[model samples]
Target: MRITPDTLEIGSTQKRNKNETLETFLKRITHVSLVGKAIVLMENLNFCKNLNVLYLYDNKITYITGLECCRNLTRLYLQNNAIEEITGLDVGLDRLNVLHLHNNRIRRITGLHLLPSLEHLKLDNQRLDPGEQLEFDGECLLALASSLRYLTLTNNHIKDISPLEKLKSLESLDLAVNSIQDVEPLESLLSACSYLSNVNVLGNPVANAGPPVKLRQRLILASPTLTCLNEKDIPQVERMFVENMRHAQRSRRSAKDHNHTRDQTTSLGVSGTAGVATPACQEEKPFPHLPPFASQYRDLMLSQLTKNTATERRLSDSNLHISPRKVASAAEALHRD
Candidate 1:
């Protein structure tokens, strides 16, 4: 059914169709839903100052306006719309606690700095390009950092999330189906947001980098306080076991590298010592008292005597031999000649 500003009670129950004035309607109604009506603009809602919950989702609304009088609003659902930007929400949403803006054309996260009481925010399924990262106004988010607890930005083409480190009170975060390729930024969240326990990164590149079991173990190791990952609860025993295993692996690798380096150093040292020792041992002179020329001549005479002995052996085998005295006499005669 179509519901316009003038015919606001078209789809409402019979109690709200009792021909009541706008003031009476505003005073009695606490919740309203004008969904699936192709609504382009929000009007005639200024009298709804007492409204606590409003659902205007699945419409063609291009902007957020006409809600400045809803100061008592706590929950707002504006998802599945054509909203290109977030504005006009700084007026009367101080009491707003929950906001759902999923499936919209929003590219930048803004218009939330004044919402000091905001707790849960969902902005998933935005109209973003491939490889396009979600941008944020750090100052705006920082203003609400303390009050924000649950944040869902899934499937928004987001890659960098360093700005979220300031959300110290954040408890649950959903960042699935994005382009986050690194888990280091998330590690910071563990320390910054002491209360953070649940995290969803199911469709990111980091999640697909390894097997599911290993990924879970790595994430658990990264954040020791994490109790849930990708909607699965992580038991304390599993976390402890993964941490211990990682520690043991690191120790083994370190020891192996150390031993390898030591072995290489020892082998080099032994080879160097052996090379020097062989030369030093051989350099020790056996005949230090002998003159340099006399030692050389003595070594030559011994070599000649040894050659004569071998020649005599060969001559005897042929039935011919020379006596030692004859050999000596021939040597002296040759020397004289």
Candidate 2:
């Protein structure tokens, strides 16, 4: 019944007691590191019943094997290896919480539903081509949806994330440097996964569509419950302000469009004006009995009108002077004198 936690380092030499059996070694070691040994197959690991953490990264392991008997395994690091498919992990490692399989050849996500306690699953840069998208098995994801919370799929060429809609318990998700082009899937995620508050979608096509402020506003509006986006916290007041600004902008744009359409219609109706005097034309005509000065200053007024047409003149009280008619009368009097 005496249990002692100890770490065993099996270096490149793979040296061990010549007479020690695998069962005896397994019963003694709680952590093991066989990193960078060019090991291909995962053998001699079944006897590690007390093994809680195993690091086998930077090797040539083609498939996931060994450790089938390590029921107490909690953390397994198999990153930077040659794991093409995610298999061979069964119910034995049910207690596994952190599993790092990044830099491998895993094209499809599978064989992970067996780990009911898995929380963090890292699978970034899984040997995918420049534009190739990573695929996932729906059933496998649904199985992990309840327990898996922190998941990283960076640089995986993932475009569609509909399969993650069932991850209601997921809290933090990293999809940075991916090929995602739409934010609709993330909106669905926010609606489905209530606990998902932190999300990273940087370096994606969707994030580059607009300015940072506009993109952040769109994301916040899409997911009001989000507390963190692209590593930045979304304060409550900021969220409210962004939403209000978006609403106001939409209203202004709609009003401008409506006014423009109305003006176009009015212009079309008043196109032909040979005998028809439009209201605008009638309003500009001078009164008949304004004296001979009105006719004399008509050319000056027309010149002023032509100049004003190029730009809008802001009329203020400070700029007001004698009426145009009075000015015209004074000029005529001066000429007569």
Candidate 3:
């Protein structure tokens, strides 16, 4: 059987190899769009039976019905096809390991369990709107979970991925834009899959749910191998933590400020006594009146009292308003006083 010329069409490289066998033709050709008619001709030639790899992406095929004849097929590239359903794939292709169905219209995954050897599966652009159905869509995912090691379901409508725990062998999983919020799923992943090393939840609510530092800490504790986490979207948590520390420092500052004010007030009172003392005799009667020192003492006492009162009022304010700078300033002020 001779592989057709139309099936080998690729850019200016569309020249046909008339002498090649059907199997050689399919194997040599790559990056060609296999439309429905070309696929039918290939199916009729029975040439795909011995084929180990097939590139049928960017095609007009609506279903996976044509690939049943290629039983020995190990890698199938059917990306950018018009296929809507994922059923009826059980066939002679038991050796199939890598299936790239990216950019397909597949709404549901139904017949994926048949390929027990499947190691890496990409349904990234299927737009699977698994409404209400939280976990794997029935047995298909269950079978995959049993053998699948790497899976990418990015750019889909998948919401609750807690079901991924079923994939005991999964090592790398990409669920970037899902609607999951809680970090509870991490626990399940850690418990079920001991080898899980990487997880990308960058654009989801879970990323923005908590403090980045704290979240990073918790994730590190959960999986020491977890090298990356994307919780930076939660700016509020970061801000809140900063605000809390600022408030604490402010409080300490106010306390210091109050103490400083108190010391200044006491010093002023003692200094004022210097001018009011008698001539080392009859001092008990009290010196006549206010000297410059006494005036200075009075002004100093009033300023100290005012500062102390202001500091107390500020300390009583909400802890949210305090800042680190204020605390340091207060400490310095207390030292000077």
Count of clashing residue pairs in every prediction? 0, 0, 2
Tens digits of per-residue lDDT for model 1, 1-337: 3345445544333245467775676655678778888888888777666778888999998899888888898999999999988898899588999999999999999989889899999999998766566778888889888899999999988888888887888889999998888777777666677888899999999888778897777678777678999999998888888988999999999999999987765565444333435455334334334445445555566566657665443333222223434445445555566
Per-residue lDDT tens digits for candidate 3, residues 1-337, read: 2235444433213344778664566544433434333342234324334456666676666666656656777777777777776754687567888988878777666678788999988877664445622235667778887778888877676666766777888877777776767777766666677666777776767778877565554554565445445523324454456556667888999999999998866654545344455465433432234445444554565466556665444433222223334444444555567
lDDT of 3 at 83: 74
- The TM-score values for the models, in the order shown, are 0.72, 0.67, 0.56
Which 10 consecutive residues of model 1 have the lowest summed lDDT? 313-322
Query: Candidate 1 local accuracy as lDDT?
Result: 0.78
Q: What is candidate 3's local distance difference test score?
A: 0.62
Q: Could you give the candidate ranking by TM-score, starting with the highest?
A: 1, 2, 3
CA deviation > 4 Å runs, candidate 2: 1-25, 246-337
**lDDT score of residue 68 within candidate 1:** 80
Please, what is the whole-model Cα lDDT of each candidate in the order they appear?
A: 0.78, 0.77, 0.62
- Evaluate candidate 1 by giving its C-alpha RMSD to the native, one decimal: 14.1
Q: Any residue pairs clashing in model 1, and if so which?
A: none
lDDT for model 2, please. Answer: 0.77
